[model samples]
Target: MNLTVLRKDFLAGVVVFLVALPLSLGIAQACDLPAFAGLLSGVIGGVVVTLFSPSRFAVSGPAAGLVTIVTGAVATLGSYSLVLLAIAIAGLLQAAFGLLRAGRWIGLIPDSVIQGMMVAIGLQLVLQQIPVFTGAETAAAGELFSPACLSVAAGAMLILLLWQQP
Candidate 1:
């Protein structure tokens, strides 16, 4: 690579580092884990995967999507270290997926359908949590919005909606 490109990449990396710190911390807090764990995952994704990942532009890190996966695994396995073992298994599965190019069909999805799905996901987040805010949390506490925590979560939610409007 050219020196100019390398210099720009270094500068961009510094910015990405700064931008990632708080986002990673917030994700850890939401998932009920120590912030250092999130930082460790970021470090592993940045260093370990860089050695072998074929795609140069793909973002790999402690993802929010893995919240359910990690939590479920923890509940099943009863330890976070065991969750790391599961992650290794998942990493192998993902590497196989990349090698097989299994995501080749992702581009074939209709834009309208994809857009509709995105809209549905957004609405689902609000609707699913509404029951909690209305005081239905007695059903499932650790769920997206627990019945017990619903009353507590309502104010934060109202603020979110109000913040969105203006």
Candidate 2:
């Protein structure tokens, strides 16, 4: 392996770890799990991905997209152990899909659509952080465009634009 590539990957891994630490805790709380579980999940995910994942660039961590499903499953099952079983079964199913080469269908998506989806997801993440930026206790629906939120969002965008400059 090239030393420069290795160095860049190590730096990226550290950055991902830093970001994933708090995110994992937040995601676990969203799912009604203990904070320790989030930390453990992050660690275990890193180890498993490092050992087994086919792609070095694959990011493994808890995600906001799973929050509703996890919360609902916990509420219905009434036990974390059962939720873990469900997660294990889901993992097995995902592996089965991979083995079946189902992921090849993603190639059918147009590059433009995929890029647009990525931009949408990034915008959603930025919008979701507006309340935090504005120190709001809670953001109600339809209030994301309030002046304070917009100001913070604009400032954030400006900083990102400036930071990306050569």
Candidate 3:
């Protein structure tokens, strides 16, 4: 409510945007969708979701786990637009469930089951990126292995690992 609080919130938002931008793009790439789709989704999550959120500090955004499900949906639907329609329908269903207070049922599931699902999602996400990281794009017509791409990926990973040191 105060000016200092507002400034701190703004700074936090800037940090979130910096982190979410590349993450959104990567998720879009993993989903086989254009970069703009990711940016648009991030913007909607940050802006539209914020507008409707009951908590002032709540932040919402896309997750990497969605890549597998979305990729499969696009493949099965055979059209990006159809997949988007399906997503919209799913969102409506989710909202309806939320209105009905269905989230309380989530506690019925065991914590181990939830953790196992998250582990599976994380594993799938890593496996999906293996081809890109290895430069073995299945849809590509040219070289199977690209040293240039590999080097860039390796360099990025090295930098990330170094940055995480305490």
Candidate 4:
């Protein structure tokens, strides 16, 4: 690649690395694991495999979007080693997709469908946050939207309204 293009790629990578740090830590915690795994994966994707990668300006790292899938895989596999095995398998699949140039299919996704998916994700986040915002003490209770929760939530709203001075 040209020197100017390489410099731009390096600059883009610095931006991505900063963003990836917090995202990976959050994802690792949510996945019930240490943050180092995410860092390790990022190092491999960024420095090691990056030499052979096609995307020059794209910085690679552990994505928070995979938290749900990684956590589910760990629960199903019942071991961290197995979770790593699954990750390896996923990498292979991703390589195969790249080899087949399946990335072209991303253009086929309709904007409406993508927007609907985003809206759905937002709703799910709100539902998940309710318990935390209401000071939920027990995750074992399995009641995300209980009467007590709603009452506590209402009380918090009232407090916010009364405390607002500006």
Best by TM-score: 3
List the candidates' TM-scores in order: 0.57, 0.61, 0.87, 0.61
List the pairs of residues colliding in candidate 3: none
For model 1, how does the per-residue alpha-carbon lDDT over 1-166 read when each residue is reduced to its tens digit?
Answer: 9999999989988888887777677566545568897887788778877787678875556555555556567778987788778889998998899889989978899999989877765565456546546655465565454545764576777888889854
Error of 3 at 103 (Å): 0.4
**Local accuracy of candidate 3 as per-residue lDDT tens digits, 1-166:** 8999889988998999999999999889888899999999999878878888899678788888888899999899999899999989998999999899999999999999999989999999888777788788743577786677788889999999889856
Cα deviation in Å at residue 127, candidate 3? Answer: 1.5
Judge candidate 4 against the unseen true structure and give its global Cα lDDT, from 0 to 1.
0.75
Best by lDDT: 3
Candidate 1 vs candidate 3: the lDDT winner is: 3
Instruction: Rank the candidate models, highest TM-score first.
Output: 3, 2, 4, 1
lDDT, residue 138, model 4: 47
lDDT of 2 by residue, 11-78 (tens): 99899989999999988976789999889988998888879888957788877766667878999999
Q: Superposing every Cα of model 4 onto the true structure, what RMSD results? A: 7.2
Candidate 1 minimal-lDDT segment of 10 residues: 139-148
Query: Which 10 successive residues of model 4 have the least lDDT summed?
Result: 137-146
What is the Cα-based TM-score of model 2?
A: 0.61
RMSD (CA, Å), candidate 3 to true, equals 2.4
The global Cα lDDT (0 to 1) of model 3 is 0.88
In terms of TM-score, which candidate is stronger, 1 or 4? 4
